[model samples]
Structure formats: C-alpha cells, structure tokens
Target: MPRRVTVLEVGLLVVLVGLAGCAGMGTSVESTATSTTDPATTAGATTADTPVSTPGSGYETRTVTLRDENGTRLATVDVWVADTFTKRYVGLSDTSALEPGRGMLFVFDGEDGRSFVMRNMDFPLDMVFVAADGTITTIHHAPVESDGDLTEYTGRAKYVLEVPMGYTNRTGVDVGDRLRVDGA
Candidate 1:
C-alpha cells in the first residue's frame, strides 16, 4: 500500500516551503546592517578599523569621497558595495536604519538608465546617481512608502549611492558633483 497526499496537504506544504525560502533571504542583509563601526572615523579612509568584509554577506565596504565641481572635497561616506545582481536587488531594504555618513553603493556594468524603488525599506534615502566618469547625474530624496505603493526613481548612472534621507542636502552633494570610491 502507498500513502496518498490530499490537495489541502500539498498546498500547505508548498506554502511552508515558500515561507522558509523567504525567511532566509534577509540573513545576510541583517548581519551587514548590525555593524557597530563609528562612521566618523571610517569616512574618507579605508583602514583596518573600517571593516571591508561583512560576515555572511558578499558586500564589501569602501570609502567614497564626494567632490565638488572644482575637485574640492564635499563629503565622505563609507558604503557597502553592491556589485552583483543579488546584492543590488536586496540592497538596504532589510535594514532598519542607515547610520549617518554610511550608505550603500550599487555598481553596474556600464552607464545606463536605471530605476530604483524603496521596496520594504524601513527608512528614507537620498539616491545619488553617478555616471561612469564619476559625474553625478541625479539626486533624489526618496521617501519611504507610507501606503503599499512604491515610487520609482529613475536616472542615468553607472553607480547609485543610497544614503540617509537629506544626506545630499546636508553634505552639499548635488548634481554635477563627483564621486570617488576607494580602490575602485
């Protein structure tokens, strides 16, 4: 005799499996978010004190320097590099808060028009889009979705940096500025 499975049982099993998969998705993102590094000391320098490797996450931390049009330093930020598809897709959505002077930098293969949304994000952000030549093309102060609707911020960029809300304004980082990533 063989055991038979009912339709309801099969549906329940499928639901459980889906939930299990989703549960594991935030493991890396959460680990990376919990870093206790002091952003003040980590800015503009890539040192041993500023960890580069995030445990359980493929993200690499790098110091990014923002410069004005005349090459004067505007601001410095420590950013987690999101170069791969999976890393970029997850982004900082799983994190609750982005520390001051800390951000996530998304790198693409080449300059192209791209779009980003605050999907499942717990905080607002300022999205800075940079061209391949390091010129900033756009800056958007994106707000967290109050409703279920997500707004897309589109720009032409090879790199997109997401920082705390009003960061661009606070740091005087504006369109046409330049972004220099350490060791990039």
Candidate 2:
C-alpha cells in the first residue's frame, strides 16, 4: 500500500528546496552568516559587552598607605591588588574623582619589560613604573582621553604606580624615589 503525502511534509520539502536554491553562495558568506546569526558561533562578537578592567573592578581593595621621610601620612590610596587579566588590562578609567591621597597599584606576578598607554581615560595620571627592587624605572605623564597617543615607560618593572595627575610632582615622587610597596 502507498502512503499518503501530507501537507506538512510538502511544505517542509518546498522550504528545503527554496533554501537549497539559495545555498551555493560561498564558503566565506555561509560561514559569516552562520557566525553572525548564531549566538554560540558569534560568542567573540559579544565580548565587547563585557566590562573593562579598571581600578573599580569588583576585586577586594588593599590599602597602600604612603608616608614621608618624617613619618607623616602623605597619602592613603585604595588599590585593587590582583594579578589577573581583567585587573591589569583595565587599569584606571572612568574615574571622576581621585582623592589626593589615593591611587591604584598594579602588581605583576613576574618581572618583565612593560609599557602602558592612556586610552578611554577620563583624566590624566602619572605612571611610575617600578622595578622589583623598589626602584622606579620610568615616569610618564599620561594625558586625558588623548586617543591613540601612547605614553610608554620602557623598563623592566613588576609594579605600575598610577596616581592622579600632578600627584607625583606634588608629593615629590621622582624617578629616583624609592617606592615601598606594602612594606617591601
């Protein structure tokens, strides 16, 4: 006995026939369509929605209290101490208010020659790249929102000191100034 053809099967066959007619576009075009339309295939495209790393990351805050030669408290900065990708990459951005005695300190797990740039930043900052021995390698004055203008401190450093603009000069934190990082 022959089976009867159903309307649902006929409709599916017609839809497949129509899709087959439109199939031979190109490998690149097909792959692009699949990737752009499917969430699993287009996972990388959504990475931009992820939050950027910065001082305001949801990491625990570690206080880095500063003192002068006279043992006077010069500044007390609330720093996010984490050797993670998000914290290191995000640095300091979107900070509308930076208290006079506060700053962010990025501690690298290892020592290497590193450089920094200011992009998407709301305000200026003074970058003090410090070596493992608490010696400052280089100091750069990063300008505010100066897109594509990279300020690099070329030196082998394990720590990056980020403070408000003019804070370095105001506190007399010079290139030769020895930085004491958490009793180091």
Candidate 3:
C-alpha cells in the first residue's frame, strides 16, 4: 500500500523548501558538476610549509575568477581543483580556515547530480555550483556541522566551488553569473 503523507509533514516540506531557496540553495538536493573555469591541474603544489595564496586542503592551486552578469570582476579565488577521485573525496574535510580569495573547486566528469555535506568542517562556506558552460546554477551556504545527515548543499550542478561563508554576499556573486578559470 502507498504511504500517506500527513498535513503536518507536507507543511514541513513546504517550509523547508522555502528555507532552502532563501538560503541560496535549490529546492531539490542534487550533486554538482565540473569546474566552471576549467583550470589546468599540475602535480607540484604549495604544501603546508608554503602558503602562497593557498587553497582548501592545499593541493594543486589554480586561479579561478568570478564575474557578475555585467562583466564586472567580483573575486579572484586561488583554488585547488579536485579532478581526481581521491582529491574530490577528501575535499576540505578537515579545514578550519579558508583564507579570503581562496577555496576548492570540485570538477566532475560530466553533468553531476549529487549533493555535498559538511563533514569535519570547522568553518562556514558558500558552495557555488556551476554548469559545464560556466553558468552559476546555485549558491549554498554550508555551515560547520556534522555530516551524519549529509545534508545536500546544491542542485544539479556540473561544477561546485566552495568558498568562504560570506564570499557570495561580499562579492555580489549571484546565480547565472558566468565564471572563468585561468591557466586551465
């Protein structure tokens, strides 16, 4: 027999969806896509000893830029592209501080539909999901919380860019903004 949804349950769902939308997240939970900027990946990178515009997890760094719809420069973020499986799996898991103008970019193979959780995160973050064509789809704020529930932070995105908590608001990065990656 099909399960019946109570009025309270439906109401709660509606409220939650509304809240997610207000928080710059999509109503439905989904995975992200590739890097919006398509930055080139190199083996040698700035390790813990060196912090020259370091990115989350201090992996191979790339220059990623976010611009407004009007072609205005917003932010120049130094990011580590998570192109491999291992790198993508351990993305910013135990990071405490992600300096200004720095973050991690999760680049997937194709159009992705998976959600990300804040596991072992010590600082708040703003995850920007971008399409393969470099279109910003959704911007989600992932607070420092446990990953027990694995609360998704984005919708059907091809690329996911995780930045500082206030990066979006501070830089005026809104959905539909086209971004580019330098030296990709």
How does residue 79 of candidate 1 score in lDDT? 79
lDDT of 3 by residue, 1-184 (tens): 1123368855865686689779875334422212211122221222466433222343777787888888887767777787765466556664544344457888777766647777556556778888888889888876776657766665666678886665677667899997787886
lDDT of 2 by residue, 1-184 (tens): 1123368855764575467558842111000000011111221122444433334436656555444445554544556554554455445544443433445677776666666666446566677777787666777776664556454445567877776556656655666556665644
lDDT (CA) per prediction: 0.67, 0.52, 0.63
Q: How well does candidate 2 score on lDDT at residue 107?
A: 76
Off by over 4 Å in 2: 1-57, 65-76
Off by over 4 Å in 3: 1-58
lDDT of 1 by residue, 64-139 (tens): 8989999988877877888875567557666654444567888888887777787656567778889999999998
What order do candidates take by lDDT, descending? 1, 3, 2
TM-score of decoy 2 = 0.59
